[model samples]
Target: MKKFLLSILMGCSLLEAAAQTAFTVNHGPYLQEVTQDGATIVFTTSRKAFSWVELKQHDAPEAEAVKHFNSKDGLKEAWNTFSLVRVEHLKPGTSYDYRIISKEMRSFQPYKVVYGDSIATKWHTFSTIDPQKRGGSFFITSDMHFDAAKLEKLLHAADYRTCDAFFYAGDMTSYIDKFEIPFTSFIDTSVKLFASSVPFEVVRGNHETRGNLARTYSSYFPKKNGKIYGSCLLGDVMVVMLDSGEDKAENHWVYAGLNDYDAYRTEQAEWLKELMNTKEYKKAKYRIVISHFPMVMSQQWKDEKEWVGWEDAIRKFLPVLNKGNVDLLVSGHTHRYFFHEQNVDGNNFPVLEQGESSAVRLELHGGKVQFQVIGVDGKILMEKTISKK
Candidate 1:
C-alpha cells in the first residue's frame, strides 16, 4: 500500500513540473517602430502569463539593468499572453542586450495575488537607430498572401538582420478572413525572422480589408498613434507609410455595405497636406513614401469596368505627394514588379513595386538612394541608384 501511494505522489509531482514548463514563447520578441529615443518589442507566450523585458547596455553588467513592462493595468493578469512592451529613454545608436521574462500569474484580485514559476528567454542584443548616421539600409517586401513557406524562405534570402529596419508594404496575408491566419501568417513569420531586434514598418493593403476579421487587423499589428498612415525619420531618410484602402468601391457588391474608404482617404489627404507643411517633412534630405497601392495605375485598368478603387487615392493623394516633393514612392500590390519614373500621371516621384515573394533593399544616406530587388531564389532582380531631387 505504501509503495502504491508513493507512485501516485510522484506522478502528481511530475505533472506539476510539466505544467510549469509549458509557458513557452510561441512567437515574436520582434521589434517595431524603433526610434532614437525608444523602441517597442512585441511577443507572445504559449500560455497566459505576465511578461516584461529586462535590458541593459550590451556590455553592461546585469546589475545595472531595468525592467520594462506593459504593467499599466498592474501586470497581475494571468491571461496576458500577447505583450507590447515599450522601452523608453534609450540611447540612440547604442547596443543593448535584452531578454523577455514571463511569470505565470495564477490569479490576481484586489489585494490578493498568486504566481507560478517564471521563464526567461535567452539574451539577444539590438542596436538603436543612429541619430547622426550619414546613411542606413532597410529591407522592403509585400504581397505574402499568407504563404508562410514563401515568407520564411524570403526572410532567409533577404538577410533581414543586416538592415536597420524592415518594411512590409501590404498583403502580408490573404483576406485576413480568419483572425488567427494573420497571427499565423504575418506575426509568426515576422518574429521568426527578426527576433524582436530589427524594426518593422507595416502598411495596410486592399486584401487586408476583406472578411470579418479585417476590422480587427490592427489589434495584431498596432502602430504609432494607432494609425495606419504616418511618417518617421529613420537615420536621414523620412519614410511615410500610407493605407490605400480596399481595391473596390465602398458600394461594390463585394463590400456588403461595410466600408467608407473614400471618406477615410479624403480625411487622410487633409492630414497629409498638413504634415507636408511641417518643418520636419520639409527639412529631410531624403523623403520616401511607402504605399500598398501605386498612385499611377497601369494602362490595362483604365477602363471603368476594371477600376480597382484607385480613383479616390489618386485624386486625393497625388497632388499632396507631388507638392510634398517626395523623393520616391515604394509600393507593392500588383504582384508583378515594375518601376515607374514619373509615369503617365502628372506625378513627380518615381515608384518602385516589388513582385510577389521578392524583397527590396534600400540604402539611404547623404543625397543618394541605392536599392536592389532580390528574387525568391536569392538572385538580384534589379539594382539602381538615384539622387535626391
Candidate 2:
C-alpha cells in the first residue's frame, strides 16, 4: 500500500512540472507598436519555447495568403523570446489575418528561431487606422510602464476608451532585467483593451538598451527600420523618429565601446539634412520629431543616470528642423509633459517636452494647438495653447 501511494505522488509531481512548463509559454502572443504601411498589418509578437514561428497575411482570420518570414539569424539560437515580423505593403484601412505558431520543442533547436519556438499561439486580427488624409483624432500617452497596482488605479480613474487612435512614445516596459516577459504583458493589456484597432507608432527609449531589449523591441516591431531611425508621414504631420540607443552616461553603448556618439551624429546628420528636404516634409503643415529622450533638461535632477550628453547632439539635430520649418519636437523621458516655444530662423517652432505620463489631451484646429496634461483623478496639471502669427 505504501509503495502504491508513493507512485501516485511521483506521477502528480511530474504532471505539475509539465503543466508549469507549458503555462509559461502558453499565454497568448501579445501585440503592440502597431503601424500600417498601405494595408499590411505590422506589429510585434513574443512567446516561449515553441518549435516554429511563421507569419501569413490572409484575407480572413483563418485563410492563408501567407506572406511568411524568418528571423534575422534564423531561430536555432536563443536570443530573446520576442520576435518581430511585418507583412509588406498592405492596403489602407484593411483588416489582416495573422497566426503565430509554436510547435513542441525538439531536443535540438529548430529552423534557427524561425517557426520552432516563440510565436503567437493563435490567430489574431488587427485593423489598420486611416492615414492623415483621412484625418482623425488619436490619443498620445507616454510612460505607462506597467505596475498592476498603478495601472489598475489609473484604469479606474478615467474613461480612456473614447479616442479613435492611440500612440505610445516609448518605455512600454519597465523591466530591463528579465527583458521579455514584462514587455509582453504590457502589449497584451493594450490589445485586450482594444487599443490595437488603430495604428500606433512606437519610439525606442533608453530602457530598450538592455541585453535582449533591442531584440525584443525588434521582435515586436519588425517593420521599424532595420535600425529604427527614420521618418514617416502621419496625416498632416511629418514624423521623424530617432533612436538615441541608450545614451545616458553609464549604461549606453557609448560606455561599452559599442557606439561612437560623434560618428553616429555625423551619419544621421546627413539623413536629417536630406529628409528635411523631402516633398512630404516641405509641404506638410505639421512636422514633429518623436524621440524617447526629451529635447531639454528634466524639471529636477533625480540621479546620474537621468542625465546624458544627448542635449549636445539634439542641439546639432534641431538646426536642420529649424532651417526646414519643422513645427514641434516631442519626447517622453522625463515623465512630465511641458510645452515651450522658441524662434528658429525667425519662425516659431513649438517645443513640447514630455516624460512618461498617462495621457496627453490636445486639439489642433484653425491652425492653433492647445495641449492639456490630464493626470489621475481628472486633475489638469498643465495646459498650453499656441496661436500662429
Task: List the candidates' TM-scores in order.
Answer: 0.89, 0.71
Which runs of model 1 end up more than 4 angstroms from their true locations?
1-21, 73-78, 109-111, 177-179
Worst ten in a row by lDDT for model 1: 70-79
**For model 2, what is the error of residue 185's alpha carbon versus the real structure, in angstroms, after optimal superposition?**
7.2
Off by over 4 Å in 2: 1-15, 23-67, 71-81, 107-123, 129-132, 143-160, 171-175, 181-185, 194-199, 210-220, 245-259, 297-308, 344-347, 364-368
Identify the candidate with maximal lDDT: 1
> Per-residue CA lDDT of candidate 2, range 204-306, in tens?
6666555434455654544544555677665565668766545555445445754455566567767889988778777766566667765554435424544
Please report, in order, the local distance difference test score of every candidate based on alpha carbons: 0.81, 0.55
Among residues 3 or more apart in sequence or in different chains, the pairs in candidate 1 whose N, CA or C atoms overlap within 3 Å are 29-196, 30-196, 31-196
TM-score of structure candidate 2? 0.71
Root mean square deviation (Cα) for candidate 1: 3.7
